[model samples]
Target: MPVNRRITLAARPVGHPQESDFALDEVDVSSPEAGEVLVRVLWTSVDPYQRGRMSEAKSYAPSLQVGDVITAQSVGHVVESNDRRFSVGDLAVGQLGWQEYATARAGTVRPVPEELDPQTLALHAVGMTGLTAYFGLFDVGKPRAGDTVVVSCAAGAVGQIAGQLAKIAGCRAVGIAGGPEKARDLIELYGYDAAIDYKNDGVAEALRGERVDVYFDNVGGEISQAVHRRLNLGARIVICGQVSQYNAERPELSFHPGLLIMFRARMEGFLVFDYAHRYDEAARKLAHWVASGKIRWREHVTDGLENAPRAFIGMLNGENRGKALVKVAERAE
Candidate 1:
């Protein structure tokens, strides 16, 4: 019997996570049965959303109990298959968890389309991360040409793409990132016309001159409070994520909604799954942008499955410049 190494929730954290909160263990993995396939996990995703999933309190998705393997979106090749749709060696993507191998139903894993450039594309630009940026920016924010689009967490995965997409739509892209270096990348690399270093300068002061028409918010907190006060008439605010307050030990203090009534703007929160029916359409457009060199993606990767916990913590700490992922194993050429 072969062993599969796994990362499981050992203890739930009161605030910021501890390394001891995770347990790495090895167990014998089951083979694929009829109508199933066994995936040799390659690349696994670590997102801020996982922090929400760790708590027992209910949200959009179910929470995980202690000792359960951490659930995650992963990409890998089929090592064994009992279903006709998935053949051995075919690359597939699914919520496979943090493990070396997993057996999933044929319907649970979707084969990555051939047109997608790289096998790892399942994790970032052409995947859900990109799609979140797509629907949040286009459908929610609804920016137009010459509109000023402001993005928070602008150096991270979705933020970087969101800023670029605004530029592609002929909008003035303004970014708010943590450091001077990330802020510089926002202007030089991500095609942002203006960039703000929230770590050094005042976010509200940085946008004093620019007319903010649409705001794509990722790390909501004081930054969001500042942006909401500067909204132009008919402005749209897309609430993506609130990473800044995700790990607080106590309940976070939220700002009053006086500005919403004052600005007469629209502020809406959305889950990417809400747009599942339109993913293919979004993917087609995003793929075109990537091939034409308009949208770009970067990955901050950890090398081993055993290190998955650290990778997750790093992402929550704002350590990644782009998408945060764990490389579980190498693909065979």
Candidate 2:
């Protein structure tokens, strides 16, 4: 039997995931049982949602138990198979963990498009991150022509796609990011009409210049408060994420009931998993846009599995430029 390296949850974290919260170990590998396959991990996505999983707080996904492998979305190639549906060398994407290899049930793993670029397909503009942007913007935050749409965390994976989708819908798009460079990229690279550096400027004043009919909020706290104040009557706010307050000991702001009355606005939260049935539709549309050179994706990939913890921590701190991924193994050509 071969042995594989795995990273497991050493302890439940309080706020942000720490090095002490993870334990790296080498474990014996077992052959795939019936209807299962053994995969050599190629890439693993690190997302903000994982932080919520590290805590005991209730969420869409269950908290990781101590001593269990840290769960993550992984892209890999099958090295051995017990199911007839898959064979050796088949590329698949599924929920594996932070490990060099994994044994996944046949039903959970899906084959990746053979023609798609492996690296790009793993991180951005195609996978869960892209789907989140697609459904959230079109289905939830419906921006019509001439409507002003605002997105927070504008330079991130989902934000970049949502902003571009708003533009495609003929809306004037504005973005709010943490820094000047990201602000510039949101405008120049992602086609946002305007971008505000939230770290340096007054977010409310910057957004008030435009009639914001839709606000795609990724960062909550004061930023959400600012957007709430500037929302036009009947505006729709899509509560995507609250990255800013994810690490806080306690929520910084209480929900403002007054804004709901003053603007007659609607605020709704959505999870991408709810739209799983429409993933194919969203993928087709996103792929068409990518092929036409209409939408651009950015990724921050770290080189090794050893760096996964650091990469993930940095991503939560807004250090990554786009979707963050860790390369675990190279695929055979």
Best by lDDT: 1
TM-score of each: 0.96, 0.96
Q: lDDT of candidate 2 vs native?
A: 0.86
Pairs in clash, predicted candidate 2: none
Worst 10 residues of 1 by lDDT: 248-257
**Candidate 1: global Cα-lDDT?**
0.87
Screening candidate 1 with a backbone cut-off below 3 angstroms (N, C-alpha, C), the clashing residue pairs are: none
User: In candidate 2, what are the lDDT values of residues 228-285, reduced to their tens digit?
Assistant: 8788898998989988877777868735978878889888999998998888888888
Summarize candidate 1's per-residue lDDT along 195-257 as a digit string, tens digits: 899989998888788768999988887998888778898889898988887787554644467
TM-score of 1: 0.96
Cand. 2 TM to true fold: 0.96
